[model samples]
Target: MSKLLVNEKEIVVPGETLATGMDNLPGNGTYRDGENIIASRLGLVQLEGRAIKLIPLAGRYIPKTGDTIICKVIDVSINGWRLDTNSPYSAMMSLKDATFDFIARGADLTQYYDLGDYAVGKIINVTSQKLVDVTMKGPGLRKLKGGRVVEVASNKVPRIIGKAGSMVSMIKDATGCNITVGQNGLVWIEGTPENEFLAIQTIRKIENESHLSGLTDKIKAYLEKAKKK
Candidate 1:
């Protein structure tokens, strides 16, 4: 006989038994050991039919190819620029990939992307050694100006974005702020200081309560109340 040892959405730690017997299958962040299925990491439990998986609760961003992320320009070189990708590894954006227009050699790269500037970029390559390459020539990829950037748990980004972008769109409509959420966990908010503050507060609330049920309804109610104040 097979049995599920834990309830759905429960927070579990490493080595905990999630289910017993071969009837239950292990999923991501879980492994089968003998007759028992065990949690392989600290995360929230998810039950999809008979497959059990885990949603990470905390961790640093790990860059992957083809991810759209928010990056801060850290160093400008003659041929390219280096960006902090909100991860342990930084990314490189070459001149050829930075823009469609030609950039004259040794022509003061700072004129384009000066240090301390943030931009929306796309990761094009990631090496086995964790070297990352980014590009800024795509649509919606551009420098962000006059706004504050905030960080949250990268794992919770889906919840922050919500289903079909409904959560983020709601916040934008309520606070009247333009918000961009990077898959690497960096968010850029541009608007009046008051509205920006409210947006940040709402995002933090989502990150904190993402594992809870009825999160969408709760967030909608919270935003409505905040707008009244």
Candidate 2:
């Protein structure tokens, strides 16, 4: 008889059996072994009819074209800048794509984006060899000022942002902080010291409990209780 060994939203480890018969289909993060479905990685179970997939619980971000990411300026050159993309591969932003203004030749780029500064940029291209190119010429893409950056598992980002951005929006409303979530797992929060601290705490809570069901309601309750303290 076909039977599922795991429930939806259940946290499962790699190599665990998810189903016992061919009636169940393997999806992403899972594979088929004979008639059984097995998990290929540690993740949360997601069922779509007879197909079973997994949402990764933890992993490093891999750069992809069109992803908006928060990066730090690490090296400023005569024509471009090198940015740390919170991944194994770094990204480059040329002067032509750095800003809307026409910059003069040999101009000091540091005056615009100096070392150690953070910016929100969009990945424009990624080469087969992993060379990444990013652009700052877009709405809400600019240097970040006076904010705290927190790192979480990239896979938990959807839960942190919630369905249609409800989760992060709630944290912003409850704490009065401006929050920007980077698809690369970097989150920037700007507010008063107290509010920023609260936002950080709340985001950490979401990352830790992303595998659990009823997460949205739990986060809402957590924020309400924190406000009372």
Candidate 3:
């Protein structure tokens, strides 16, 4: 017989039994312990058919190929720009990958991106040595201006994005801020100062209470209350 010991979206601690019997398959954030499936980390339980996974409550970012992320330009070199990827490893974007225009040697690269500039980029590849290469030549990828960037636990990104972006969409509708969530956990918000602060508060709230069920509704209520203040 198969049994679930915890409810979906419940916060579970390490070694807690999630499910039992062969019909229940363990997924990310979970492991099998004898006949029982156990939580491997503190996270929220997610059920999909007979398979179960957990969304981690918190963790640092790990760079991966094809992930869209927000990066800050740290330095510009002769061939490329070094960016702070919000990971231990920095990423480089060559001039060729930055734009379609052929930039001449000795052309002022700062004209395109200078130190302290933020950009939306995609990880093109990650080497065995942990070298990360990124690109900016794609739809909706560009330099970010006149906004503040905030970060959450990288593992919590999926929850912030929600199922098919429902959560982010809700934040946008409630706050009226143009928000961009990076896979690396960095978030950029652009709007009036008040709206930007509201968006930041909303995102931080989601990060803290992500493991709770009815999180979307909770955030909605929080945002509504902010409107009265």
Each model's backbone clash number:
0, 0, 0
Worst 10 residues of 2 by lDDT: 53-62
Q: Model-by-model lDDT, in order? A: 0.93, 0.93, 0.91
Candidate closer to the true structure by lDDT (higher is better), 1 or 3: 1
Looking at model 3, which ten-residue stretch has the lowest summed lDDT? 53-62
Could you tell me the TM-score of candidate 3?
Answer: 0.81
Best first by TM-score, ranked: 1, 2, 3
Clashing pairs in 3: none
Question: Clash number for model 1?
Answer: 0
Alpha-carbon shift of residue 89 in model 1 (angstroms): 1.0
The candidate that achieves the highest TM-score relative to the unseen native structure? 1
Decreasing lDDT order of the candidates: 2, 1, 3
Kindly list the per-residue Cα lDDT of model 3 for residues 1-229, writing each as its tens digit.
8888989889999989999888999999999988999999988899988889998776678799999999999999999899999999999999899988889889999999999999999999999998999999899899999889998889878879998999999989988899999999899999889999989888888888876889988888898899888
Superposition TM-score, candidate 1 onto the true structure: 0.89
Q: RMSD to native for every prediction?
A: 2.1, 2.8, 3.2
TM-score, per-candidate, Cα-based: 0.89, 0.85, 0.81
Residue 152, candidate 3: how far off, in angstroms? 1.5
